[model samples]
Target: MKNSRGSLVRPHPLPESASRPVVTPLSPSVVYASDTPDALDAQYEGRVHGYTYSREGHPNADVVAARLDGMEGVAGGVVTGSGMAAVSAVLLGLLKAGDHVIGGNQLYGRSLRMMKEDLPRLDIATSLADPGDVKAVEAAIRPETKLILVEAVSNPTLRVADIDGLAKLAKDRGILLAVDNTFTTPRAFRPFEHGADIVIHSITKLLAGHSDVMLGWVAAKDPALAQRLRVFSVTAGLTASPFDCWLAERGMLTFDLRFERAQATAAALADHLATLPGVKRVIYPMRADHPDHTRAAALLQGQGCNMVSFELKGGREAANAFTRAAEGLSFAPTLGDVGTTLSHPASSSHRALTPEERAALGLSEGFFRVSVGLEEPKALLAIFAEAVAAAVPGA
Candidate 1:
């Protein structure tokens, strides 16, 4: 096949200096430097040259980073050992002793923990906002705010953030907008196209598809930023294993297909659950009743995704019963897998939160999260109905 302009795709070549003299290969010269007895600079190549050590760079990591770059539609990208590693890389890269960050109130628990712990310790500060509230985000900004971060789709609640709006706000404020795109995946929401300076994903979740590996990555338009982050990833020394990278590469190919089926199932399942007798509320992007449904319609390319959250009228008693009755279902605390997985966010993912904090985020003991899977929609519905019915607390 050929392009309309009749040109063949070609690989970018290494600079001339890199192709000869096995240029400056790392050795005992210094643990972190070239190991060869010969003076390292004698065979120097361009700065983009290969590893002086695996901590600096690795061929497999490069392969994974390029694959992630293509998926994220960015000028450059990097893979880290986990999602937090990528987040920390961006924070460490942009934040200084006195800088501050503004972020959505619905943050991953670890992120909340990090801010409450690390930033204060470093003399850097942070501001929190409900990303759903434009006014809240706007007001939270301080003169020291250097970044505004939000998840494209929040965990547990599945609140689809006002991505374009937040990105624009960040741009207007000269703040970097780094979006955590894990929940929505590249298939559901492409944040970079909406003005995000950086898009990060927890490849361990939907990206790997099968839940066999743990990896995270960041994609960005600025090659300089990407290159800088690549250095940070290396110096931080948390690059994914070569085999894990290989698995992620393989898993990414089937991402679209898997999520398409799962999303349909999710919609069906959520719709039915919402109509059930004891169901108080169902939160998913496409549902018209969702608080952010309008923003979801504008920001999400499709009708939400494969995650759903619902509250039971009976609170913790009903939630616990529903979980206990999940015989055939996987009652796991994890999300995004082939098997239908359920999690009780108030206790599992957000257990670290103070009662007041959990209430502020609308995550309560009655809230149950469901990661819909590739199973037939009807079967999922039947299982859900049966579980809910059997566990009716008042019954």
Candidate 2:
């Protein structure tokens, strides 16, 4: 097993100065600073040095991967360019042409595209089902099915899947179950604990916390599967950049603190939004009204995660008005940032879906998804209350 260049396959030795460290301990290296040509050779050879190329592997990425592996209780793992890349790697690494996959209809829009559009192009077939519905999932399985892809908590609409149930179904059928645990970090939920075969994370979200880094991670329950995933990442050039890895690792250090604060804020907001004048409905797993409140509570450790999806009574106009009036909140398309931000799925995340498709998923024109931040819940509630009052006509 050699990379494009013929480098010796050996471990990259630690720099002699590694013994010394700062107060917090930071291990950041652009390249494995070591004996030059031999190091280069070692990299090409995919040797024991821990990393060969920045694209294939790096020290920063290694730390993040290791930390994630520990948190998820995985046998091994790899970080990728983005969450989507991790999704691509899992499908590409584990399945080939003529293979069939069962994908959730509730996946993020781009993920849906990957399964609906890209998989077919690769000669792989996929059937979309409600990942939370055990019977529906079982019915969708085919003789050629090799994988079942699901999100622990669905995007925008906040549907929670039954990971343990799905895992049993997959195992009984000899199929792999990959759970995207991005929404609920390991602090809230670890998919592996539920017998998931592969756990995936869009480290860009809560794991990274700051929304500055774009990275993804795939943790495999089996070392052999991890090796295969690593090979796909290296060969396919889907590995994460070292700097992003460093940022992601830094983010993980305070993950518990950040997640706790944001999740609390999200729960409070969900409760408050239901009483707001312009609010039509609020959707959060913690809410008694949520479709999967009980299941989510059991699987997610009684945390609502750092997200809340709500609809404005005034429809799209009110949604737009609230965004325009909301002070200090960014109208960003992405989620899991340190600061509170509002994203409209009809216009951003699920914009690709046709009107009928969006409607089918319950993503209405007034739908607004809030990525709860670390702000004080009272202050955030004040801001939203004022914004809603200003936005809703005659309120």
Candidate 3:
């Protein structure tokens, strides 16, 4: 006979059934039980299929990774705690001291910071180049360069990279090209199909299609490279929680529908903003006036993403007033939500850069980014038009 406390702690296991649940069951256990020491050793040695620790690997993360792999059409992938974790896992996992990295100047600010600030601390060298300019990237590469990193579509600025050109250059130089496809997602672009060695994503964005989860993933065209990244992620303890993974997977079910709705709204908004009184410029990949319009058309197949950025003639004051007057919009620092939101790049995304650096990137005081959402186009257009009038008064 067992004591009450012992009996309570050791609950009876559920009976096995042939029928399976329609939805995948969420497994939140951090540690798993093994039949014996030999079985545990076999699992640890990779001779058997099982999870021992959540930090190394788990069922939820595996399922999500598999789905991402299918979407990217890659050999394999791994999920991490955050987008930055995926970035760090790739950079820190593959490169060692004395190696060099050539990265795009217009990447997400934190990624740029990691290259310029963090990599240097570890004795690794980094150089910045305009990813849209393939010749400039090639010029920046050195004999020791092991990696070339760029975003499929740059943050806030919306500079589209020449992925094919960059991939060819990297391959000829024996360097790996890592493309961050967070902004574009797989629906807009697939890096692997175009010769990229690695593809990264901030799954918190359009892939998840909601702002509920903070998760990211990295996929590799080569199985060996994917294994390397997975090992490094485990060692660094960058694995995502089961709950986050589950939430992200759920969000992915509606990704295509959500993305299509947001993209349509963004396109209409871009055209409307360009004709407004106080608007100075609109930056959208599909716009003919965009710097990378031709390349974006070819790569994205005329399907631009949901992100839209514009500059106001009144700069900071006008931006502040617009946010205050905008009826249905929220002033959020992050992006990819169901509700339309505005973000100030100068104060939010690109604040890490020095004033001079930010000016060079064309992120001025009036610059604002819009994450279009599932909203009625007419209502949003009216709201923005009224706010613009209120902000720049009589312009």
Candidate 4:
């Protein structure tokens, strides 16, 4: 018999059985053991289907990647620690120094910062263009341009990119087009279907649908690109934790249902908010007044995205008052929660941009973005009505 210390260190393995688990088991072990060194080598060399280390690859990550691959209709995919990690994997893994990249002007603030600030430090060149204008993107491309990055539907402002036109341009130019689909998710739009080479997602957002886990993924239509991203993700140590992956998968189980309800509420809210007093403008892709409404209608499915952005006439002071007066709504800097939440763009998402840059994008101090939740529509409308009244005062 073994001593107490030895027994405590090594617990008995569960007995093998024919029964299978309905949910994917969380395998958090950092390392795995094999029968022989040769077996381990085979696993590491990809000669067999197994995991040797969590950083290189793990069961939970693989399962989630496969699910994303199916959803995005890609050849393969890799999940990363965060949305920015996935973005970095693509930028760093695929491109090298001296290569040029064309990015949309309306990309997520952090992503735009990477293109504008970070890539230049690494000797890579970047140009910003209006993704809504395909000709403008093509004009920005140069001989060394290797990639064109755009969001399917832009952040905060809700500008829709012309993916098909951009994809064709990239193909004609022999460059790759990467679309960030976090705002639209696969339910609203699948970039691969529109001839995009790569699809990226901040799984922390709508896909997970609960705002609980921080995760992201990149899916490539080409197997080689997917492999490159996976290799770099491991080398850079951007792999996600097993527990976060498990929670993300659990949240995704109700993604379709949750997305539908939230988007429906968003459409109603957008219409109602536009009619409210002191409302300067409302930004939603489904709305006819949106600049990209036609393109959005062509690209998006169902009711479009679950996000709504509105500006108040009273500016910053009004925004503060509205947040204070809104009883049921929470003032969250982030989005995609079970309950309706509000985000102030100038303070949170686009805080890095200078006043001139934000003004060019029409992101004013009173501009607010809403992530519609599963709350009753009537209650939400009432909350907004009262909040707008408090903010505008006599409006």
Counting clashing residue pairs in each candidate, in order, gives 5, 10, 0, 0
Residue 229 lDDT in model 2? 94
How does model 3 score by TM-score?
0.97
lDDT order of candidates, best first? Answer: 3, 4, 2, 1
Local error of candidate 4 at 373, Å? 0.7
Q: All candidates' TM-scores? A: 0.87, 0.91, 0.97, 0.97
> Of the candidates numbered 1 and 2, which has the greater TM-score value?
2
lDDT of 3: 0.92
Task: Name the weakest run of 10 consecutive residues (lDDT summed) in model 1.
Answer: 22-31
* Deviation from native of the Cα of residue 367 in model 3, angstroms: 0.4
lDDT of 3 by residue, 57-95 (tens): 899999899999999997569999999999998899999
The regions of model 1 sitting more than 4 angstroms off are: 1-49, 393-395
What's the C-alpha lDDT at position 293 in model 2? 87
Error of 4 at 394 (Å): 1.8
lDDT of 2 by residue, 176-269 (tens): 9999998988888988889899999999998888988999999788889999999999899997877788788888889999988999899999
**Tens digit per residue, CA lDDT, model 1, 1-395:** 54654364533433566456422232222123454635455434554354556555566667767777777787668888888888888887667899999877898888777777887898989888888777789998898898888888888778778877887888898888999998888787788898999888888887787767788898667788877787777777867776777677677778888889989899888899987887778998888898888888888855578899998878788888888886678877777788889888787878989989898888887788888888877878988888888677443
Which portions of model 4 miss their true places by more than 4 Å?
Answer: 1-8
Those runs of model 3 whose alpha carbons end farther than 4 Å from true positions after fitting are 1-8
Write model 4 residue lDDT over 24-135, tens digit each, in one string: 9999999977889999888778799898889988899888888888888875799999998999999989999999999999988999899999999999999999999999
Give the alpha-carbon lDDT of every model: 0.79, 0.88, 0.92, 0.90
Cα displacement (angstroms), candidate 2, residue 41, comes to 8.2
